[model samples]
Structures are given as C-alpha cells and as structure tokens.
Target: MGADVIERYVTDLGSRLQGSRRQVRDLLTETRDSLTDATEAHLDDGLTEAEAQERAVEEFGPVREIAHEYQAELAVAYGTRTLVWLAIVLPLMHMAWEYGRMLLIGPWQDFGTMPPAWYLFIAQANDLTSGIASGVALVALILGRILARKYDTRLLAKVGAGVAVVAVGTVLLGNISIILATAHLDAARLVQSAPMLVATLISWIVIIRFGLLARRCLSCATIVA
Candidate 1:
C-alpha cells in the first residue's frame, strides 16, 4: 500500500511537470528517496504501513507544489543553455552566410561594369551592422548565463529573457538593414543574397522559439530546495 501511494504520487508529480520525462524523473529522484526514508521512519515508530505512507506523503506536500518547484528550476536551466547555444551558433552562421554571399557576388567576380563606389560602401555598412549585432548577442549570452547560474530568482530569469529578446531583435534588425542595403545594389546582388536571406530567416525562427521558452521560464516561480 505504501509503495502504491509513493508510485502514484510520483506519477502524478511527473505528469504535472513540463520537461522531458527523463528530466522530470531525474529531478524528482532525490525527493522520492527522501520521502521513502521518511516513510520508513514512520513505520519504525509503530505506525501501520498505510498510515506511515500517508504521513510521508503529507510531509512531502502536494504533488503540484513540488512539481512546480522543480519545473521552475528546470525551465531556467534550460533557458540559459538554449540561449548560450544560440548566441554561439547564430553569429557564426550569419557570418558564414555573409561571406558566402560576398564571394558569390564580389565586384571583381563578374562586372560588365563596376557598380558605384557607394554600393560597396553600403555593403560595408551592412557588414558593420552584422558585427554589432553579433557583439550584442554575445553580451546577452554571457550576462544571461551568469545570472541563471548565480541566482534562482524569477526576476533574474526574466532579465535574462529580456536580454535574449533584445539579442534576437538586434539580429533581425541587422538582417533587415542588410536586405535594404542590397536593394541599392544590382538586382543580381539580391539574387545572390537569397541563400543568406534564407539562412537569416531560419535563424530568426530559432531565436524566436528560444525566446518564447525563455518567457515561459520567466513566468515560473523560483524554486527553493
């Protein structure tokens, strides 16, 4: 009877959590072991098995409460990791796409008539914007990871989410600026930019997904354990 209660409690708790099943299980393992130990103690005190199990479960508190605590922590941890990976990856991919586009349409590559010097200047400005965006993303990533690891507060996590949102917005702004700059150049240049445009779109989607996850983390209460 005691074992059944424990199993049901854990199953219910797991059902309430938001992470992967394995992650939820791992998070609750220590809690389950502690509850079991408490139950054993109650049994040693001469309580019946069912009574001991009931007491142990009561001491552990409601399943929803425990699950919410664990879920909040998991959400913050996962948010930090996701943002860090995006910060590292998206910048590199953006740079690579830019390089590829430049190589495909460099002035010297195919120029029946060399475009205006202003066109090259605009291209350089676009590169500068990309560089600025990459730097901001790195800053956001570093700050977010530090905050997530150092503090277990919803406020800090919310701040991290804000940083991530800013980073995403900055990158999108840079991409749009580049696209606009491309319009001042030859139509062939825009065609050459298609691959980079596609890459930017994909990166935007990834960043937005993570940003939404970060918001979810922000909504959860801080875990205390």
Candidate 2:
C-alpha cells in the first residue's frame, strides 16, 4: 500500500472506535506518525516509498487489531483509575454519612430501649458485619485495580463477583437490623424518623446499584476479551 492509502486506513479505523473526534484523531495521528517513522527508516535501506509503506503496514498488522489494542489499553487505564477513586472516596463517604446520622438524630430510637445486653450484642454484631463487609470490598477494589493494570479480564470478573457478594451480604445485614429494631420498638416512631429511614433506604439502593454496576463491568470484560 502507498503512504496515503495506509494513512487513510488508519484514520478510518480510528473513526470506527467510539470516542470524541479529537480523541480519535489524536490516536490515529500518533499511529500514523509512528508508522511513518518506521517507513522512513525502511526507505533509508534503499526501498521505494511504496515498498516501505507496504512493509510498515505489514509490520503494524491489521488496522482493526491495532485499534482494538489501543482501545483496550485506554479502557483499562481509565477503569483502574476510576475504581481506585471509588475505593478511596466511597468508604469514607459512607462512614461520614453514618456518623452524621448517628449524631444528628441519636441512635435508632426504636431499638434504644431494648434490654442492655440485647443492644450491646446487636451493636457488636453490626460493627463486626460492617467491618467485614468494608474490608472485603476494599480488597476487591484493590485487586480489581491491579487486574485492570494487567488487562486481565477474568481477574476483573472475579473482583466484580467479590464486590457483588459483599454488597449483598451488607444489604442483608442492614435489612435484618432494621426489621429487628422496628419489631422491638415503636413502628410508628421508626416511620416518623424520616431521616433514618431515608438513609437506610439509600444505603440499600447504593448496594443494589453497585451489584448491577459490577455485573455490567464483568460483562464488558467478557465481551472485550
């Protein structure tokens, strides 16, 4: 292929991959410049421009294959950074919100009057469950980040599975605690505490959302692989 033909093929390949026009242009420009440099080097060895271009194209392999490799690398980098940000910010945000709720409205009023031993036990259990869930989630997020760096889709899927499991377990524990509190104390009072109820519901919703997002991420990994 001639230089113009090779350049057009690379440009067309870039257009086919989803992204902003600027991004696609930048990627194609980089690829084209690199190939041009290689072709120039080959030309210095006494090959004609057309022959050099052809050899460069052959060395670069198929345009689609090159584009896919570029896209996957970019995706893994973006996804890893995103996961790391979420890992750092999310747990801290959740803890802050939980503490804020406790301070603002006091403990779950419905369960406060329960036997001292029962409250102590339940509180311990709550802490234990929360700690375990958070620890597991943090580890999963970290592993996912590492796997993403390696572009190991299978490992990413495993990380997603771990996250989904922890999320489900946390949701289950939260719901059970709410039920027990409502059963032992005044249902009316619990309902009246709109902030507490809303917070709980939001927490559950977030868990469900994470589960769904993880599944989608896993599916993307599978499709890409």
Candidate 3:
C-alpha cells in the first residue's frame, strides 16, 4: 500500500512536469530513495509499517508542491532545449525544401547542365548560413546542458542565450534570403509551405521564451551572488 501510494504520487508528478525524461525519472528515483530511507528509520524506531510509511510521506511534504517547485526550474531547461532543436532543424528543413523545389522546377541554361552561377552562389550561401546556424545551435545545446545540470552560473546561462539568439537570427536571415531569392513566394507557395511557416512562428516563440527565462535566471543568480 505504501509503495502503491508512492508510485501514484510520482506518476502524478511526472504527468504535471515538463523537462527531460531522464531528469524527471532521476528525480522520482531520488524521491523514492529518500522516502524509503525515512520509512526504514521510522521502522527501526519501533513504529508499525503503516505508521512508518505515513510518516515518511509526511516528511517529504506534499508531492504536488514539490513538483511545482521542480516545474519552475525545469520549464526553463525545457525551453532552452526546445529552442536549440528548432534552431538546428527548422533552417535545414527549409533550405532542403527550397533546394528540392528548385531542382524540380527551376530553369536551366542548357540540356542536362548545372544551374546558373547565381543559383550556385545562392545555394552555397544558404548552405554556409545553415552551417553557421547549426554550429551556434550546437554551442547553445552544450551550454544549456551545463546550465540545466548546474542550475546556476550566470555566465553559462548568458552565453547559452546569446548563442541561441545568434542561431535563431541566422535561421531568420536564411529564411528571408531564400524568400527573396526564390520566385515561388506566390499564393501557391504560401499554401504549400504553410506548415513550415507556422513552425517558424513557433520557433520564434520558443526563442523568445528561452531568452526571457535565461535572463531571469541570470538576474536571480546575480541577486543570490
């Protein structure tokens, strides 16, 4: 019965929180360990099993409240991770779609020949931009992991946010360049790429959210320091 109660509480907490799955699992495992230890201590003190279990649960406080506290911390880490992923993926997908579309329908100067010099230049530029964005995203991912693990260090958080901003900015600029360079910005293209556009909007939102949270964490760290 005590084990069942602990399982249910951890399950409920897991449903309510947002973060890395591994981290959440680790937290639950730690909670279980602490509760078990407390229960064992109570039992050693001559308490009944039921009484010990109840005391253990009470000592840990309410699951919902503790989960809320964890949510506050993990939400920022989740946002940081989400932004890093979108920064890396969205641009690459957009560039791939653009290039694929061009290969299928673009005008070629000769039969079975390569695209024009301008086309090659633009493609190279897009690839280079995407590469730089991906590099920034990698940096952001590494720094975000450090921030999440340490849950402190204002400098690391700031650097992570800065890298995320650069990555998102690069993606934005790449998208704009693709739009300007292509002749497919008509209603048909808009309808076809609507999902991608919506994803871009969501990416922007994630970037803004992560950036704000990172700044808030930095501010708090400064105050604590």
Using TM-score as the measure, the top candidate is 1
Model 1, global lDDT: 0.64
**CA shift of 11, model 2, Å:** 4.8
Which is superior by lDDT, 2 or 3? 2
Candidate 2 residue 141 Cα shift, in angstroms, is 5.1
Local error of candidate 1 at residue 195 (angstroms): 6.1
Runs in model 2 deviating more than 4 A are 1-30, 39-54, 71-79, 110-133, 141-216
Write the residue-wise lDDT of candidate 3 on 186-212 in tens digits.
334434555555654665565465455
lDDT leader: 1
TM-score of each: 0.67, 0.54, 0.49
Instruction: Score each candidate by Cα lDDT.
Output: 0.64, 0.62, 0.61
lDDT of 2 at 21: 46
In model 1, which regions exceed 4 Å deviation? 1-3, 19-22, 107-134, 137-152, 180-190, 193-225
- By descending TM-score, how would the candidates be arranged? 1, 2, 3
Report the lDDT of model 2 for residue 186. 45
**Candidate 2 TM-score to native:** 0.54
